[model samples]
Target chain A: GIQVEQSPPDLILQEGANSTLRCNFSDSVNNLQWFHQNPWGQLINLFYIPSGTKQNGRLSATTVATERYSLLYISSSQTTDSGVYFCAVGEGNSGGSNYKLTFGKGTLLTVNP
Target chain B: DTAVSQTPKYLVTQMGNDKSIKCEQNLGHDTMYWYKQDSKKFLKIMFSYNNKELIINETVPNRFSPKSPDKAHLNLHINSLELGDSAVYFCASSRLRGEAFFGQGTRLTVV
Candidate 1:
């Protein structure tokens, strides 16, 4: 089993601010994703960066597979961005079917207006 | 639209009852999974199915069973539900080694 740890378990920011969240894993991963759990309980896929960097709108993610760490950045946050952000990782195996993903405890973000 | 969808966004039941949550994905993925978010909002994997076969079964209770009739569908059934069974259950699907897509989640309440 892979161990994923997220930092700053609770974060609060005023609207229009910027923040960064970090996730550290104990082993090399074949798949890594960042998800935003909105207030309505929908797990929205933010990024699927097993390695390298990716950006979408106000969010961006970078994964350093060799270092076993990943970072998610949110810029110009809005009230709608308030929710829990999760980072999940799946280990690499010879079978080529890593069906299970290990999720971090999540970083609860609260963006106020 | 091509997405992963689950039935019954919410469920309320009494102890000793039996309930089931169904999930389907049209992303042409071969793997489906069930995850439970407890009261503290800690999400954990309960079961994983690859191409209609069980592969990853965590230390979930025996009262909980997962069935995958096809590569696109995976359902979870819980028997003799207890107060501790109340939580948000999520169904997700992914390719053999790709990122996963999750459902809206079912919030179950046990009385």
Candidate 2:
């Protein structure tokens, strides 16, 4: 089983601030995903970057597969962005059909208006 | 339309009761999963089903059973639910090594 660790267990910032959350894994992974669990408990997919970089609106993520690390950047955060950010990784021989995703404890982000 | 949806967004039952949570995916994905989020917000995979076949079954207790009738649906049944079973359960679906979509989550409170 692969272990995923998220940094900065807690974070607080003003609405206009910027922040970076990181995730590190202990082993190689075939799938790496970033998710935002909003205050309403809806798990929204942020990015599915197994490698390279991807940006979505005010949020962006980069995954360095070889280094087994990923970073999610939020620019000019809004109050709606306040919630738990999770990083999950999947490691197994069956591509993704039968593999299970192991999730990190998550980074709790609070963006105050 | 919701890509992944589950019934009974909130469930409350007494101990020794049996309850079931139903999940369905419209994404036509072959892989579906059941994940549990504890009070501390720690998420963990409990079961995984691919093409209606059981694949990954974590160290979950025998009281928790997952059934997939078709590739698009997966349901979880808990027998004699215990106090420790109180948590938010999530249903998700994804393609092969693709981005997974999660349901709104079913918060279960076992007394």
DockQ list for all candidates: 0.76, 0.79
Worst 10 residues of 2 chain A by lDDT: A91-100
Clashing pairs in 1: none
**Model 1 DockQ vs. reference:** 0.76
| Model 1 agreement with the true structure over B4-56: per-residue lDDT tens digits | 99988999999999999999999999999999999887899998888898888
- CA lDDT, every model vs. true structure: 0.92, 0.94
Per-residue lDDT tens digits of candidate 2, residues B1-111? 999999989999999999999999999899999999999999999999988988888889999999999999999999999999999999999886677899999999998
Kindly list the per-residue Cα lDDT of model 1 for residues A54-104, writing each as its tens digit. Answer: 999999999999999999999999999999999999875769554578899
Off by over 4 Å in 1: none
Between which residue pairs do clashes occur in model 2?
A: none
* Docking quality band of candidate 2, CAPRI definitions: medium
Q: Which ranges in model 2 have alpha carbons more than 4 Å from their true place?
A: A94-97
